[model samples]
Target: MAHELIYMDNSATSPVDEEVLKEMLPYFNEKFGNASTLYRLGVDAKKALDKARQQVADLINADVDEITFTSGGTESDNMAIKGVALSEIQKATDKNPRNHIITTTIEHPAVLETCKFLEKFGFEVTYLPVDEDGLISLDDLENAIKESTILITIMHSNNEIGTIQPTKEIGEIARKHNVLFHSDAVQSAGKIPVDVKDQNIDILSLSGHKINGPKGIGAIYIKKGVRFEVFMHGGGQEKGLRSGTENMPGIVGLGKAAELARENLETRMQHNKEIRDALIEKVTSQIKDAYVNGSLEKRLPNNVHFRFSGIEGESLILRLDNEGIDGATGSACSTHDLKGSHVLAAIGVKPALSHGSLRLSIGPENSIDDVDYIVASIKKVVDYLRELSPLWDNETDEYIGDRFEKPLEDEDIDRY
Candidate 1:
């Protein structure tokens, strides 16, 4: 009972599993050898790196050679976008035109900023819009494609809202048009089943820390036939695409994490969903006028988002921290930005409600007791904050008494 710091922020990151930590310990001391060297230690390190590559590739049904290790998700995205841009210009045959990239306005900064940088070099970018449910319409995506479009980069799942995009449809569109497609699966990889081959992903990005692995390591899966220029160039490592000395320990840790995640995908997914649903159910049942933000049907198994009106999300997160519950107000990267989440605002959430948005993402290691603790803490915090508001006039205390058995008497309950 004492070890009860409830963590509901798996979307931001997760604690490295004890086994994964053990696997990485060797590279820090006894096995500290440059993967590019020719000695025995180096040989062992190189083999470990290669095996790790296969592990990551296996998770996504990609070829081992297709996966290139990067610092993390951001670098993978930058490499995907910038690498394609440079490669296109260098090898543009005929009047194929080196012009534009099509992406959604709701993309993560990794994709958004990369598109902005490519624009500085005379390339055009079209940022498509998303509907109120955080789903980008297929028709809008179709209209955005241009004659000079070189790539389409979108996220597989929204980090804040947990809305899973129609990646398969988008991939099909890209492939039909002969344009490249890249999906940043940093949030979706371990949370859901992702097969790059089945999705027809030209390029994919995933981070290690998201799947109970060590931080500072990620992978980019470039389809075997796809051509992308090198982002990191030096030694002949990574087939000359990435040249730095490999992070053997981090890679080993990543491999172990990936393997474990794949092996337990179904079981972990079911357990996480049960815990997540309990959190969502308990919060809405006990709190007044609280609701889940994003598509309930097409969402991550462990994600539960909420927009608690009349309270600042940053304040709620701080309050939750005091209650020994760790969660988030949107992405960890935007904690200090003070802009109140462009992702939430993009889905047409009001500025006031958007300011109070919180994302509670669960991990496989968490338990029902953890969810119950989080729910209880949230009920107390939200009730306290709502009491302070002069605008709290429509509070309810029925707790869905009879509606639980009936076939949804109240239409608005599902929306909540």
Candidate 2:
């Protein structure tokens, strides 16, 4: 008999919703027109795009004009970071060159790498460190700000460990210092409440695929009156901020997905939380020497991350795949890299423990049965891999168990 397949990698990407697909179908042929054109077909496409903008705006509690569609989260991150930096530099006087950006060490590569890229252009960057619970200190962020500090970009929720950052506090700090604040909300937008206005966020990035919409479509919310230079150049589209032919079908799909997400956010969050809590409870209780990563109480409702000693995460993932279960070790974007997760390292996870990390993010489609199956399958896979591990001796098991049961020592946490 074929093994039943269970998918628990929603943080990496989710399956497109049926309703979102239905909303996109007609745009392929019937409503196919360049939104930039002036004909009837073009006008219809333009109207669809406008409606989508409103949908995205409403979801984030932003003005309709603030939404700028992009290719994906990476593009949105790049546009927000670079756009703000360049815009500030242009407006800077001889004595006030705003060339510095502030971001956390645990940020997604899209944000981290963008900050790094700016460093090559004579821009300075401060990568604030996170604690063992994957939370950054508001004091550290404030101290990092200087006269050259132009923008502060951070992720709303961690992709690997699922720790939700205190973006509202960070936003207030930015506002007080007169700095532009941008957050990559790709992981938190649909799963949690993200009010740009309430958080005092000047800009935010979100992806469609992360919210059960089609891939290759995302948006950046730029608060009105926030000065930002254009990143792309072409026909004056997206108010000349992003210049290209709009992806009407993808936009419509994303809009519908956002709308549905808003309507069902509370119910979906509860469902995900139950499955996540159940899986975590079962796996930790049944599997010896297992411990969760990040702060349990402040994490995303769908995320459950854990680490097991004596086995590599990749090996466990392969073993679980044989049992028809799918999950991930770290960000899907960096899965090809053999190094330990930067997010884990930033949170002070030892290299050995980081190598064995596993991230299981539940979604609306995952049920209690699926959670049970995942727990069982993971337990089996970890046991099998542990047996093959050279470090899996009698003493090693006891040590691993003690490490999980006891509190972490001050020396255990690494600082950047």
Candidate 3:
């Protein structure tokens, strides 16, 4: 087994940076105060909040007042989607009852579930289809818009496959139709360039944990004058968008992380991309039947997704973990679902192939020196797994047994 643990599951969460931690330490003890109050402690906390808000806003090229703190990406997504849905419902008249929302089939569960929840309340949601490369058609977007279409909510990049969408074009289409455009930028904010004004985005969501900051803290960018109802009630914190006492330490850490991310964006992008490409090239060239899942050219700098025939993703992850290399089968949030990834399904990957998918999301801590070990370990594990797999045909190098047809029997569990 490898001695050092190599973390390649950054899309799940990244470790807090030392600088971020340093910035957060004082907030927990010395600077602890209610941001809503007027005392000295409160004033200090309020100043930190304002500074943090500006830090987050600067990362995405938005005005400071446009940023609102939230619990995390889920709350931010909910705020953008359901908040708009509820607000539109309130403004509905006899003739102009705008109740439609447009989103992609490959969006994160936060957006997907929120859209489903609104569907329960008589709201219409159009889940757009993506191409095999995980890109939506701009024409399809424009054609789907109707008089009742109120909002277009799409993710900047897929969390699982890391396929970037044409967000700028999508935003233009939304604006041309006079519909609000919102993007779940939780995965793309720190890893890529996300200019709300340049991208024509009306609302955006980002999380802290994904960007080397503290967890349970996030921020959303809502363009000035964009209408959305208050999702969280009480205290009127976050300018009445979200409520409850502010998590000062978390906010501070996030602000620091955002500042670092903005300052190091170019370096981060270049380093991650180099490492990502090396891993992809090494793995694909060395391993047979290893297919990349998304568009390599349009992919995120840190993302590398591959599917190997005749091997289960869970087994691959476990074997990789034993080799001191951590990876993921898909989104960490949906790993418990026990179903094939919706993103893979949307991109036309076969169900059996989807079961073999592995996502190795790189981070700043990972270096190119780690690539050979990762590829070698993966090749060895794949060989061992395939040798034992009844599904695999060694001579033909193909998957013979169908997973759907042959469910795990009692004997199979006993063998393990």
Candidate 4:
């Protein structure tokens, strides 16, 4: 069995950074206190929470009052959607309670399933389709908006294909229509710059785990003056928006992670992009029939998703694991089932190709050599599996073997 694996699945969740952990340790014990308390201990807790909030807020270019800490990205997305949806219903004197939301088919399940839940409550959702290159048309977006449209929630970057949505354009459209705008920036926050004010986003969601922060901590950036319904109601915590005792350690760590990401954003982006692009070039050129699934230029810096045709993506992933390479196939949250990627299918990839997507999301720690070894290992495992596949019956070699009954040339074999 292989040991000492290379971790290339940053998009799923990043390993916590040591420095960020150090920053959070005090909150768990020595300096622990409820921020809601009025004593000296409470004052200490409030200071830490406020500083952390400022750190997180600075990274997104939002005011401290606009940021509300949550359990994680799911709660943030839920609050952004349900919060705005509820507010829209309560304020509208018209029949706009039967409202509509516009989003894409490739959104994360947090958004997709949340919309599904809203549909059960009379909200109509229009899932716009992406093109072959995994891009939604702006014209289609404009046509989809109606006066009853209450919110436009689109992801900043797709987790699987790394396609960067035209968020600025979409935000402008939402503003022109007087609709609330939200973006799930969990996948794009640290990898790319996100400014709530500049983007015209009324609401934004992000996860700490995606950016080397503690797991269980995240924040929702609600643009000041944008009204939202409280997700939970109790004592006035989180400015009475999300009522609960704060998670001190997790929030501290998340803030440190955000600050660190801001300090190293440019350096990390350039370095990860270099390693990611090198792997893409190596895989596409060396592995026959392997092709990237998203746009070549406008993509996430640390992602390289490829389809190795005629081979199961999960099988290759398991084989890569045996060879000491850690990666992922499809979204980590939805890996329980072996269905082919819905993201690939949304882009009109063939069933055969769609079933073969391997997403190698590089992190700041990966190198060209690590990606190179992974590429070579995938080629070996795929070739061995194809040879043993009963589904394959075409010519595979120049010389006639026990498998082939007639004369054939290896060149006649399908390279893909």
Candidate 1: where is the Cα deviation over 4 Å? 1-3, 91-96, 390-416
TM-scores for the candidates: 0.92, 0.95, 0.96, 0.93
| Residue-by-residue lDDT tens digits, candidate 2, 319-351 | 888888789998999999876777787777766
lDDT of 1 by residue, 144-198 (tens): 8877888899899988888999999999989888889999999998778998888
Higher-TM-score candidate among 1 and 3? 3
RMSD after Cα superposition, model 2: 3.1
Q: Which 10-residue window in model 2 sums to the lowest lDDT?
A: 407-416
RMSD of 4: 6.0
Residue 158 CA displacement from its true place in model 2, Å: 0.6
| Candidate number of the best TM-score | 3
Off by over 4 Å in 3: 401-416
Tens-digit lDDT track of model 4 for 1-416:
57577998899999999999999998888989999999998899999999999999999999999999999989999999999888877766565553789988888888888988998998889888888777889999999998789999999999899999888888998999888889999998888888887888889999999999999999999988887888689987999998999999999999999999999999999998889888888888997667899998889998888877666777888988999888888789888855556677678665555667789887777776676678789889878766665534436522112252233222211110
Q: On lDDT, who's better, 2 or 3? A: 3
Better of 1 and 4 by lDDT: 4
For model 2, what is the C-alpha lDDT against the true structure?
0.89
Clashing pairs in 1: none
